[model samples]
Target: MPLRALFGLLLCAGCAPLSAQDATRAPEPNTRVPAGVVRYAPSVFPDRIVLSPAQDAAHGFAVAWRTDATVAAPVLEIVTAGDSPDMGTPRQVRASSRELRTENGIARHHRADVDGLLADTLYAWRVQGGGTWSAWHHARTAPAPGAPLALLYFGDTQNKNVSLTTRVVREAMRHAPDARLALFAGDLVSGGDGEDDNEWGEWFEANESLPTSMAVAPAPGNHEYFEEFEDTPRERRVLGAHWPLQFALPGNGAPGAERTSYWFDYQDVRVAVIDGTSALDLGTAQAQARWLDGVLAASPHRWNIVVTHQPFYSPRAGRDNALLRKHLLPVIRRHAVDLVLQGHDHVYGRRLPGEAPTPVFVVSVAGAKQYRLSEQAQRTMRPVAEDTQLFQVVRIDGAHLRYEARTATGRLYDAFELRDDGSAKSLVDLPEGRIDERRCERAKTLKGRADRCWE
Candidate 1:
């Protein structure tokens, strides 16, 4: 029987047709919302405002937001910062808009790229949806070349409890108020596919305290891709519909992997965001590997970091991204990448100064979801944490890079520093009091594992 005919027959018999892809599509048991609940609201005014780094941060930045269909034309108002408190005349730019039909309702997503701004200067901008306009938000352009820089990093926040993630982000912001950029290591939502408007809304709501002025750099995780249909035989998984519409990321990446897998330079650091889902599932790993090497080789920035969903060195025993490690690890080692930030494993683990002078690999979680530390992780990964929500603040000043990881309640968990002395670099682990390690009680079923608590 033909595949289509077989699928039709299965439908008639009330049996679901499974395909090769369907076998691999992991179900997201973490999502707690009921089916058909529309969470995304397209208000008359713009909301979910987000700022992303431009290809050139020194002079450009991108903003994206959502509004109701009633607001046909989307516009942005930008102006140079003035000494006076009063608002000044602004330059208006017409933004391109698109309509997205979610489970709840249709929403108009708008994005604008503003350029020709002064370097190392502060600017204020706002968006308009119909007659309503957003409040003024301020952002600073990238500082002069080789200037000091700081950034906030978060791991997987995919959880039924977004407030936990929200608290972590808020606490991190309080600690690093001057951070120029915020990087999410992926799995930003509990929904594997980005189709859950409510989950997306929860994520945005959690980050309400984060200023729209700061640039956000996000990587895609497995949860961001969902199987289009379960009844069909050809179970194709694709990127979430909201992934691209919500983020106006840099586009300087490989041909097939444009916005999702791209690289950008900010001051003295070069950051690369790679799509691990595409690499592992869509056969784009080779392309990403080649692009990574080219980007690392061409970059002139003193510090190089790569962000992806899966770690090059898997922290969990059974969970392993062997292909990613095989394809990208060599390039990362050869180029001496400074740091690799990753998420997916719902635990915190890092391998600093591995074997030789290799890049520091880190996997962390910022959400309430907790997983058991693998036996391998327990033996190898130093200061591993389970059932703990945490965030990291990294500061780079010339030759020195300092990283601090703190729990959601603002307790220091782990700290480290990497110093580059022109010829060689050294990793110095800073002393910090961390909570006790969490483990799982001997259990047989999924429910038992889920019910496991902190030790």
Candidate 2:
């Protein structure tokens, strides 16, 4: 059967293509103060507001935010968004709150699970902390099962988040204004531990209020882990404190890995997030592997995508993640996963299906960090980029999945189309005249002196 026959030919049903003019336009600089320049301390008002998808995104969703301890009990108010000024009677839900101690001070985090929503419905919501209500934000539920879908995927936004990464993130949003979800491959923060409040603040500020409307699914990166000393010479690296306190993820993940390793469905796609850091260093590799095998074995969705912080195929020279690949690659290959989106190498490389075990393996960096590509990657990955920040837009309609990677300023960097006709899959690279491959030899100023190659 033809792929279009198997799945309807709606190709990004609700998404508008980024016009050639818009694609090549210059990126606007962020006006907000960079998180690196100032401290982002929690206050009496609600901040860091974010939304995450539920196990069944069509029926439910999760929202989380941070506030000062004085707020006590916070509440979330929601209603079907309407064009009229009056939103009718609103539904109120009390949030579950938790107290957290950060380097800045003590703050409270609140999460509310909003369920029983109609599929593909648009709703408006707001959070209240200390009698102050945040500006109402709009969110739409996922399309009905088997419907066309669109989403955004980002690589590491670890360094210079507000200053440098925000431009890339905003540019991606411009290209896919109606994207339902924003997926992060991890290393969300540069701080490897201690949960730097300033960095977290910068990350949220960089994203602004975009996450309140779109859901976020982030995998754990090594930068989100650190060693803790407790009367032992060698302390195990543990997940940072900011992770759980900031995002309210679905609790339906691997037992040992919990939030860091989980899976969720959005329309016909099943996104499985793997906790590569904990799996490799925290002795949970086997457990996650088993859990992953089971997850993929039981997935009923038409497309399966795995998101992680560490790449199965390393793009940077001398940065191979052998253990991670050994533990997870087999499971990924066995299940014939459609795509494996990853970060951690701080370079961009996309290996097509035949070249790699999976149909597509992409390693990209969205922040200021850049690294030299390995000889293997240069030879295998056709459109690799370095010294460049990029973002990807992925769209799934019936039997076709279209992927486009664009530069921070909105230029089309690389693109491809994947079609699955129930039994077989085919891939076609889409770019004919892509911008020049960004490598260190053309760089005027070197960044990350020790880790990144200056050439």
Candidate 3:
């Protein structure tokens, strides 16, 4: 089949083509993350450290992490940092606790929602292991509502992630340490059986060091829901049973997908999250379809970013997610979304915002897994294939949003800027950097081992 067939059309149902963002020269090269951060112990287990979906309210942030049985009630504390180590003691804010368990056995995870915070303020935090603590990670929260912002996004983190994935994520953090929001659009694990559990652990440990001030908004990958079944297709399985307990989310559902699909307002941006599994596996799209339409209709925010696991449009050949496109694309278009993020293909992709006011749809992977693109891959701007590990940093400042995708070596791969001036187009390309084509064709299309690519 032709590559175009693999990804069905991703155009808006009734929207007309808006003018494209004037493609400008890429931004300057990003600096590397200091060596002090991104360090880990062989025995320390910090799988899947992350910021939750409920970050809209300025003073709040959420995080979750897993540990070896020896680690106690995993806790996170925030402290302020000065110009140098010579600076005085920092402020400390601890997250209230909710203990969670891993379906794979033995490994327990910690989920915390930190509220009552200050906006655009610099703070350092550490995830505590019993009496001891993880590294002193640093970050800042989103600007006050109606303020401009920036964000970074990644797709899947599903592979030999224990040691490798950290560098890719750190690369993004180094580019913009105070990043306001980070989006993980699924496949954070492999999700088949053993791999899903293990990879989630690795993925968490990978990012715990950088979320000091920035917040992350993640969607559950399809692998997150692989529980067994008795009737449906006999071979197919339901999503896993442990997701709800793993992370505490805002129960703000659209209409039908209460916990599975939800939305929250972050300052000037209203981000919506969904579980494609519910829509695809069960006939629940009707409810979420209505819910999404309502959420968008009710949104008063200046920006909208939708988070899902399946791409409305695929970057590789032979992959199809038509059902999702049928139910959600029209809604996304009608809402005039600014961004739609997903991961299934282990690559980096961004579609300049749209047939509507929305300008970009991106897919990024943080795990060790990578995939190949088609001959016309260049036609897909900022398409980074298998072999190269990467992550993005998106900062929203005033009316403009700046984004930089940094490679594992801390080099800027691609950068763009978007403005909210009611213009149809908004992608400002970077000036110069390495575009690793080394692993461009790392793996053939759909190699059946996508399972290995996860936990």
Candidate 2 residue spans exceeding 4 A from truth: 1-38, 192-195, 230-232, 355-357, 442-455
| Candidate 1 vs candidate 3, lDDT winner | 1
Candidate 1, which segments miss by more than 4 Å at Cα? 1-39, 192-195, 231-233, 432-447, 450-455
Candidate 3 weakest lDDT stretch, 10 residues: 14-23
Candidate 1: Cα lDDT at 418: 88
In terms of lDDT, the best-performing candidate is: 2
Full-model lDDT for every candidate: 0.80, 0.82, 0.62
Model 2 per-residue lDDT at 55: 88
lDDT of 1 by residue, 8-92 (tens): 3443343233344543445444444556655566888889899988878998898999998887778899898887867588998
Higher-lDDT candidate of 2 and 3: 2
Clashing pairs in 2: none
The 10-residue segment with the lowest total lDDT in model 2: 442-451
Weakest ten-residue segment in model 1 by summed lDDT: 442-451
